[model samples]
Target chain A: MTERDFLCLTPFLIIAIAPVMIMVVVSVLRNYKVVYGFSVLSLLAAFGSIFFVLPSIPHTIEPLLILDVYSMFFLGIIIISALLVTFLSYDYIKQLEGVREEYFIIIFTSTLGASLLAVANHFVIFFLGIETLSISLYILIAFQRSKSNSIEAGIKYLILASVSSAFLLFGMALIYTAIGSMQFGDIVAALTGHDPLSLLVRSGFGMMMVGVGFKLALVPFHMWTPDVYQGAPAPVSAFIATVSKGAVMAILIRFFFIIKGFNNHYLFIVVSGISILSMFLGNILALRQKNIKRLLGYSSIANMGYLIIILLTGSNKGIQASIFYLIAYFFTTIGAFGVIALLSTNEYEAEKIEDFKGLFWKRPFIALVFTLSLLSLAGIPVTAGFIAKFYVILEGMKAGLIVLIISMIINSVIGLYYYLRIITMLFSTPSEIKLPKLSITGNITIAIVGISILVLGIYPGWLIDLIIRFVSL
Target chain B: MNVFFYIAAVVAIISTIMAISGRNAIHSLLYLILSLLAISVIFYLLSAPFIAALEVIIYAGAIMVLFIFVTMMLNIGLERETEKKWLKPCMWIVPSLLAAVLLVNLILALKNVKSIQPDEEAILPKQVGISLFSTYLLGVEIAAILLMAGVIGAYHLGSQKKKVKHRFLEIN
Candidate 1:
C-alpha cells in the first residue's frame, strides 16, 4: 500500500492501535487511572484525526472500505461517545473490586469495530466489523461474571446474535448466487434490471433486513433487547444503545441509499409497517416498565423506528435528518446513562426507578442533566431530541407518509408519560439511601453532553448543513 | 462419478443429522467433521477446488480439532452421559425436514441442467488465489486475527481458577 492508503486509514488504525497500547501501558504501571487517562487521550486523538484528514474528501481505502464525510461524521459520534463512556467507566469500574483494566480495552475495541462498520462498503467488511463489535460486546455485557443477570444477558445476546449472523450469511449467499457479487454497487447494478418481485432476490433482501432488524431492535425481533440492556452494566448499555445502533444505522442508510431499494413499494411498505409497530409498541411497553434501563431500552427501539422513517423516505433530506437524529440521540442517551453510571456505587446498581426518586433533592446538577435528557427523549422543545423529531417528521411528511407521521406523533405523546414519570420521580423527596459522589471526570463528561444537547437543539443549522453536504455525496 | 456424488450427498445428510441429534458431544463433533468433509467434496464438484481445500483445512481440521480438545478438557465423560435430556427426537425433526426439502429442490432444479460451456482461461485455483491476495487480502488477514483471538480466548478461559476437589479418608 502507498502512503495515501496509509494516510486514508490512519483514523481507523489509530482507534485499533490505541486499545492495545493502553493494554501494554496498563500492564506495566498497573494503574487504572492512568489507563483511563490514556484511553481518553487516544479517543481525543482519534477525534482530532478526523479533522486533520478532512481535506481528503470521499477517499476509498480499498474496495472494502470508504473514508468520507459520511463516515467521519459518525466516527465523530463514536469517538465522543467512547470518550464519555471511558470517563464514566473511570468511576463505574472503581466501585467494583477485582476488575482488570481489560474493560477499557474491550470498550475501545468495540468502538473501533463500530467505526469500521460506519465505513464498510463490502459484505465481508460489514460482517467482520459487526462480529468484532458483537463479540466484544458479549464479553463486555458479562464482564461482571459473578452477576448472574450479566451472564444471562451475555448468553442470550450470543445465541440470538449467532442466529442473526446465520440469517445474514444465508442472505449473502443467496444474493451472491443471484447477482454474482457481494459489493453494494454490484448488487445495485444487478437489482436495476431485475423485477423486484423475484422470489430469490426478495427472500435474500428480506433475510438481510431481518438480520439488520435484529440489531436495530425493531418489533418481533426486539425480545432480547430489554433483557440484555437491563442486565448489562449501565455505561455499556448506553454504549450499546447509542454507538452500536448509530453505526448500524449509518451502514443501513448507506446500503439502502446505494442500492436504491426505497423505490420498491413492497420493501417500503414493510419497513413502514415495522416503523409504525415499533413506535407504538415500544412506547406502550415502556410505559409499564418499572426499571429505568429497560424503559430506555424500549424507548430506543421506538427511536430507531422513528429513525427508520427517514430511510423509508429514500431522499437526501431523509438521510440528512437521520444522521442528525442519530447524533442528537447519541448525546442525550449517553448523558442519561452517564448519570446512572455515576450513581452506581459498591453494592448496588442505580437501575430501579425508585433509586432515582428524589435525585433532584440529593444531586441537583445530575438530576437536571437527567431531566433534560428524558425531556429530549420525550421530544420536548429546547433540546436536541425535539429538533431531531421535527426533522424526521418533516421528512416523513415530505414523503407523504401521513399515517406514519401520525403514528410517530401519537407515540411521542404516549412516550411523554414515562419520561415525565422519571422526571417526577427524580424530584420526589430524597430517600434515606445515600447516593455516591460523582467523580470530576464523570461530572465533566455529563456537562459536555448536556451542553451539546442544548447547543445542538438551538443552533442545529451547522450540523444539519454538514449532514446535507455529506449525504449529497 | 455420479454415484460418488450421490454417496457423498447421503453421507453428508446423515452425518449432519447425527451431529445435531447425537447425545455425546464428542460424537456430535465427529459427525460434524464428517459432514464438513462431505461438503468439501461437494464444493470440489462445483468447480471450487480452492474453497474445498480451505473447507477441509479450516473447518474439518483446525476447528473440529479445537472443539474436540475443548470437550475433552471439560471432562464430559461417561459419568455425565446420564444427564442427557430426552430432546433428541425433537431436535432431529426440523433439520431432517429442511434437508429433505433442500434435497428434493436440488434434484428438481438439476433435472434440466445445461451443458457446461468450458472457458479455456478458467483456472479455479489461480483465480481464487489471485482474488484472495488482491481483493480479499483484508479478509485473509482478519481471519488470521480471528484464529489468534480464539487461541487467546481459549488460554484466558483455561487459566482461570479451577475448583479444588476435597480428599476422602485414606482407605489403606
Candidate 2:
C-alpha cells in the first residue's frame, strides 16, 4: 500500500489489468487477432518488467505476497508458458466455433492466477490464487462444450475440485486453530517452538496434501487427470500440465519447506508412499492407453512421482532438479500438445491413436517433432527428459532415497515401451486423414519449444548453472 | 427472544429435513424457503439484522425462487407418479442423527462463550461497507473479477446460436 510497494508489484498488476483491458476492448470491437496479440504482448511485458524491477525485488508485499529470486524464477516460467499457450490458442480457438475472443480473457486470467501462486505468502492468498486458477480452468476445460466429454470433464473437475477446496479450507481451519496464524512464516514460528508432529498439525497437513495432490494428479486423487486432459482443448491441457502444475510445485516447495513438514516421520512416510505408488500406478495404467492425451496425463503423474523423489532430499540441489525437470517437462508438453492442436480439425481433435497413424508420411516435420517430445518423455538418451530425470535421481540418491530411484528407473524403462509404441504408430503406413495446416503462431510455438528441448538436453549445464547462481545468491 | 429463537431453530431443522426428503420438487423448494426464513428469524433474534435480511433476500427470496423456477421449467419426476411416495420415518434416521450430533457439539462448544443478547446493537451496513472497501480492498477487487468471470462464463455457455424456438423449427 506504499508507493514503493506499488512499484515492486508492477509485474503482477500488469498481468491483472491485461485481461480486463482485453475484456473492454473485445466488448467494443471484437477481433481474435488483436486479442491474441494483446494477450501475448501483455504476458511478455510482465515478463520483461520482472527483470527491469529485479534490483528492487526481494520485495515483501507484507502478509499476502513476496517477490524474490525464487518467485521471480517461477514467474518467468509461468509467463513463458502462458506466452506459448496464447500462441497455440491462436490456432486452437480458431478451430472452435463462437466467442473466440473470450479465450484470451480466460487465458490471461489463468496466467494471473498462476503468477499469484508463484508469489503467495499467506494461506488466504494461496486459496484465492488456487480458486482463481481452478474456476477459470472449469470454463476453459469445458471450453469445447459442444463435445459431450468436455462438459462431463468440466462438471467432474468442478465438483471434485470444490470438494478438495473444502478439505483444504477445513485443514486451514485446523492449522489456524492449532497455531493461531495463517501466514507461512508464523505457522513455522509456532511449530518450531513446539512438537511439530502433533496430531492437529499432521491431520491439517494430511488434508492439505489431499488438496494439493488432487491438483498435481498424484495417485488415488489422480483419476480425474486422464479424463480432464483428454476432454479439454489441447492448448488448455498444455496449460494445465505446465503452468498450473508448475505453480503448485512452487507452492509445495514453499509451504513444505517453511513448515519443515518433511521432517515429521509420518509425513515423510506418507509422501514417499504416494510418490512410489504414483510411479508404479501412472506407468502401468498408461501402458494400455490408446489416447495420446490420456497417455501423457498418466506419464505426467509418474513424472510428478519422480519430481517428488528429488524434493524428498530437501536440499538446494533437489529444488534445482525439480525446477529443471519442470522446465524440460513444460517445453516438451507444450510442443507435443501444440502439434496436436495444429492437427485438430473443426470436427475432432487428433486425439485417437488412429488419428496419428502414419503421421510421419503425411507431415514429416510434425512427426519428427512428436518423436523428439515422446523420446524426451521416455527419458531416452540425448533428450531433456533424460537429463532432467538424471538430476532428480541423483538428488534422490544424495538423500539415500535409493528405493525411489530404483522404482523411477524401472518406471522409465516401462515408459520407453509405450513411448516407442507411439513412435512406431507414427511411422506406420499413412492413413487417409489429411493433416491441417499450422498457423504461423502455432508453428513458432512448436519450433521454439522443440529447439529449447534439444538445446536444454544437449547443454543443460548452462541453465543449471544459471539456476544455481540465482538460487544460491 | 431466546424462546422465539429456539422455536425458529426447531422449525428450521424440521423444514430442512422436509426440504431434502420431500418427494415433490416444488414441495422441496417451498420447504427450503421455509427453512431459510426460519434461519433468518433466528439471525434477527441474535441481533444481526443485516445478516438476517440477507438470509431472507439472498437465500430465501432470490436463490430459493431461482430453484423453484428451475424445478418448474424442468418438471422432472412428474411422469413417475408411482414414485411419489411420502417421506417415511426410516428415511429420517441418518440425517436426524447427524443433525443431533452436530447440535450437541455446537451446544458444548458454545457452553464456554457468552450468549448474544437481543438488546445488542446490530452491525451497521455502513460500517460493513467501509471495512470491506478499506481493510479488505483486495477481496473486493478479486470478488469483482470473479463476478466478471462468472458473467463471461454464463454468456459463453448460455447464449445459443439459435436465439428462439419457433413452431416450425421445434423438434418432435
Candidate 3:
C-alpha cells in the first residue's frame, strides 16, 4: 500500500483504537468519567481525521474499503452520534446495576463497526462490520442484566439479528458464486452491463434486502424493534435507532446508487412497497402507545419509511436529501432519547407516557427540550424534521411519486398526534412525582443536539447548499 | 470413492437430524460431534487437509465440548416428567418440513452449478497465507475486531456482579 492509502485510512485506525484505549484507561483508572472522556476524545479525533482526506478522496483500498465524501460524511455523523450517546448515557449507566465501565468499550467498538459500514467495499468486511456492531450491541443492550427486560431484549436482538445475518451471508455466498466477485464495484459492473445476477443473483439480492430491512426496522421485519426499544436502556435504544440504522442506510444507498436506472426494477418496486407498508403500519400502530420508548420505536419505523423513499427516487437530489435528513434525524432522535435518559434512574426506566406527566411544571427546561425534539420528529414547522421531510417531498415530487408523497404526508400527520399527546402530557398539571435532576454531561448533550436541530431547521439552506456541493453524487 | 462419499454424506445428514431431534441435550451433543467427524472426513476426501484438520479440531473438539459443558451447567436435559410434553408429534413436523425444503433446494442449486473438483496437488499452506494476508487483509483485520468484540461481550456478560449494600444498612 502507498503512503496515500495509509493516510486515507487514518480515520478508521483512530476509531478502531478507541476500544483498546478505553480498556487501558479502565485498567489504570476505574472512574467512568475518565473512561467516558477518553472515549469522546477518541471519537472526536476520528471525526477530525475525516477532514485530512476529504479534499483528495475517492481513494479506494482495493477490494475492502473506499474513502470518499459520502463515507466521510456518514463517518462524521456516526462519530458525533456516538459522542452524543456517550455523554447522554453517562448518568444512566452510572446508576446501572452491573459493571458500568466496560459499556463504553462496547459503544466504541460498535462505533468502529458503524464507521466500517460507512465505507465497506467488500461483502466479507460488510458482514464482519455488521456482526461487530451487532455483537457489541447485544452486550450493551443487556448490560443491565438485573432487569429481565434488558436481558430479553439482548436475547431477542441476538436471535433475530443472527438469523438475519445468516440470510445476508447466504445471499452473499450466492452472489459470490453467481457473479464470481465479492466486491461491490464488480457486482455493479455486472449489473450495469445487461442482465445482472441471474435468478440466483435475483434471489440473493432479495435475501440481502431482508437482512438490511431487519436492521433498518422496516415493516414485516419490524417485530423486534419495539420490544428491543422498550426493553433496553434509553441511550442504548438511541444508539440502535440512530447509529445502527443510519450506517445500514448509508451502505444501502451506496449499493443501490450503482444499480440504478430501470435495471433495479424489481428492487425499486419491492422497496417502495415496503416503504409504503412501513409508513402506514408504523404510524397506525403507534397511535395508542403509552410507552415513550415504544412510541419512538414505531415512529422510527415510519421515519425509516420516509428516509427510504428518497433512495427510490434514483437521483442526486435523492441522495442529498437522504443525507440531510439522516443528519437531522440523528440530532432530533438523540435529543429526544437523551431527555428520557436524564429523567430515568436505576429504580425505574420512566418508559410509560404517564411518567412524563406534569414535566413542564416540574422541570420546565427539560420539558421544553423534549417538546422541541418531538415537534421535529412529528415534522412540525421550524424543525429540522420539517425541512428534511420537505426535501424528501420535493424529491418524491421530482420523481413523480405522487402516491408515496401523499402517503408520507398522511403518515407524518398521523405521527403528529402521538408526539403531541406526549407534549400535552408534558404540559399537564403538576403531578406528585419528582422529575430527576439533569447531570451536566446530560445537559451538555441535550444542548448540543437541541441547538443543532434548531439551527439546521431554521437555516437549512446552509446545510442543503453544503450537501449539494459535497455529497459526492 | 463414490460409495464412500455417499456413505459419509448420509451419515453426516442423519446425525445432524438426530442431534437436533434428540430429547436429551447430552445425547444431542454426542450426535453433533459424530456429525462433525463425518463432515471432516468429507473435507479430507475433498483433499483440503488443512480445512479437514481445522474442522476436526475446532468443530469436533472445541465447539462440541463447549456446548456439552454449557448444557451441563444449565442443567437442561434428562427430565423425565417433561418427556411427554417434549415428545409431542407436533414438535417434529415443522422442523422436518423446513429441513426437507432446505435439502431439496440445496440439491437443485447444486445441480444447477458446476462444482469444482479438488486439485491433484493440494493448495500449499504458504500460498493460502500469502493470498489471505495480501489480498484479504481487510477481512483479517475485521475478523480480529469481531473476535475482540466477542471477547468483550462474553467478559461483560459472564462476569459476576457485586451486590451493593442498602442505604438503611449503611445508616445502621
lDDT (0 to 1) per candidate: 0.82, 0.83, 0.85
Best by lDDT: 3
Please provide, for model 1 over A1-473, each residue's C-alpha lDDT reduced to its tens digit, 9 standing for 90 to 100. Answer: 56777777777778778766875686578788788778888888889988888887678856887877878888888888878887888888876656457777778778877888888888998888777778777877877666789889988998998899888888888888888888877888878866555778788888988888998899878999999998888889998998889888889899988877788887888899889989999999999999999999999999999999887787888888888898899999998999988998757888999999899988999999999999999999999999999999999999998999999999999999999999999999888888977788889989998999999889999988777866653
When only the first chain is scored, the TM-scores of the models are 0.98, 0.98, 0.98
Q: Which residue ranges in model 2 land beyond 4 Å of their true spot?
A: B1-61, B76-135, B163-172
Candidates ranked by DockQ, best first? 3, 2, 1
Ranking by TM-score: 3, 1, 2
Query: Top DockQ: which candidate number?
Result: 3
Off by over 4 Å in 1: B1-14, B69-129, B141-172
lDDT of 3 by residue, A1-473 (tens): 77888889888888778788778777777887788788878878888888987777998888788888888899999988998998888899998765688998889889889889999888977898899899998998888878899899999999999999999999998888888898998987876756544888889988998999999999989999999999889999999999999999988888878767324678778888999999999999999998999999999999999989987888888999999999999999999999999999999788888999999888877788898899999999888999999999999999988988999998988998999999999998877886677788888788888889899989999889988998865
Give lDDT tens digits, candidate 3, residues B1-172. Answer: 3544566688789879988888877667766777787777666556566887788899989988998778666745655644565467664554355345434534453453334233355555787799789988877887787788889889888887664897578775
How far does residue A141 in candidate 2 sit from its true spot (Å)? 1.1
Model 3 vs. true fold: TM = 0.90
lDDT of 2 by residue, A1-473 (tens): 78877887788789889889998898799987888888888988999998887888888876777888888999999999988888888877886877878877887777777888888888877888888888888889988868898999988999999998898888998899888888888998888856546788888999999999999999988989999999999999999999999998888888877777667778789889999999999999999999999999999999888888765787777888888999999999998888888899778789888899999998888888899999999998788988999888888888898888999999999999889999999999988987787777777778888888899899899999988888621
Give TM per candidate. 0.89, 0.88, 0.90
Q: Supply the DockQ value of model 3.
A: 0.59
